[model samples]
Target chain A: MRVPILSLGEVLVASIQDALTDRGWRQLQADLLAQAGRRPPPGSRRKTAPRGVVIDLSTMDVMDSYATRSLDGIARMLALRGAETVVVGIQPGVAFAMAQLGLGLASAGTAVDLEAGLALLAEQVRGDGRHHGA
Target chain B: MAVTMAPESRLPVRDDGEIVGARRAARALAATLGFSETDLTMIATAVSEIARNMVEYGGGGEMTFAVIDGDGRVPGRRGLRITATDHGPGIPDVERAMQDGYTTGRGLGLGLPGARRLMDEFRVESAVGVGTTVSMTKWVV
Candidate 1:
């Protein structure tokens, strides 16, 4: 199934609700990249470029090495498109397991929850004035 | 440890969907054994890693789960044992395979070592051109 991606002004949000299959992950990557390249509908007031992307994993209870690689790949791909990636809502248990497994997403920003994630994105946008003011 | 409950289930690991199914099955069993949310998540993650490895590198395999009762010294100790087996080309070097950042596939190379860390006990046996089997266990405190 396609994980929905919601656009909030200059930031894109995707809440992963379930364990994704390999195909689902591949599709999500393609969809996110495609959405990032989309232009504001002719004469729309919103900004044409996305400044940041927030991936909420609150509902997800488990992540394996493959999933970790997928997240890292997505972050790298978004960086190439000039968008910062923030992964939020990692549970304490999941964090422990990830650390034990030596899985780390070094390139992406991480936060405790959705609010912090959005705030982090906003801070990034404000810090780099080029992507501010939708 | 004596086998208090020999309850066992086998799941086919052929694709990504099957891998998720295997994780769910393992989680359900672990949950019933009074595993904490953290423990459940750890077991599920380990299951996923091994199941995926079976499908990816082992050319499809099977996952078997069983419950074991601890001895008198460790009273009330219960653990879930998960075994994954595949009849495919086996790992040439188990030592290198267990090392971090050593992957033959397009992955982060954390599957074997990561799964081992998440579980209390881990054992693997493989022979070139024969097959591979990985067994892991998580105990309840």
Candidate 2:
């Protein structure tokens, strides 16, 4: 399915606890990738793929190597969907640790203020103006 | 009031379940001192990574969780102690293991150093064949 690039409205998030399970997230990512390849229903108003994902990692304070890599994995999966992910509300220490582990904001995608992230998603939907084939 | 600590809890590193158990224990200890949800998640993620490292690299081992009250010297802090030990071949070089993206397998070598970043204190002791013990503590004041 060719991921649409203009239909994004509200962000979608998979189950956090579920994704954290052993290789469970990997499977989800795969499913998302497959879904990304499809087009919206006939006569849909939106034009682009859904604005990727907004991981509400606000509940996180401590992170280990696995979580860092898992995040990267999630980011990579989203990219396959032709949508970018924006991580918001991350604490300084957590952000620092992620950078130390090489999971920096830039490596995965744009790390922006919450407002900016929403705006970027809206902008992507508005600017594309073309319905990408599914 | 004198309180006793939980004796080490150990489980084979067979799956993420083991990691969850260890993180739950760590979170419970953190809760006793009023840790925020963000803090709890951080500790959980860190512990989960270490536990995964034990299973993947160490060929499986066990994890331990304990609690500690930071000494006055540290000022305004209490802690939850988590230790994951493995009998499998110990890390050849602790320093190298701490580096990011340093992995021998399809893994990101963020386990050790990532945990250190999440906690207020981190210590590691390992010997080739002897074993490895990683002790970490997250503070909650």
Q: Model 2, range B1-141, lDDT digits (tens) per residue?
A: 333465555556667666666666766666766877667767777777788888787877777666665455664446677777888788888888887657766676667776777677888889999788898877774
Q: What does candidate 2's lDDT look like per residue over A1-134, in tens digits?
A: 11112324545443243324556556656655555555667788755456566554554555556665666777777776776666655666566656655565443534345566566656655565565552
Tens-digit lDDT track of model 1 for A41-134: 8787895688789999998888887888899899999988989999999998888888888889998999999999999999887787865554
- What is candidate 1's CA lDDT for residue A101? 86
Q: All models, DockQ values?
A: 0.80, 0.34
Across B5-118, the per-residue lDDT of candidate 1 in tens digits comes to: 676898899999999899999999999899999999999999999998899899999999998887446866889999999998999999999998899987667889989989
Q: Best by DockQ, which number?
A: 1
Supply the TM-score for candidate 1: 0.95
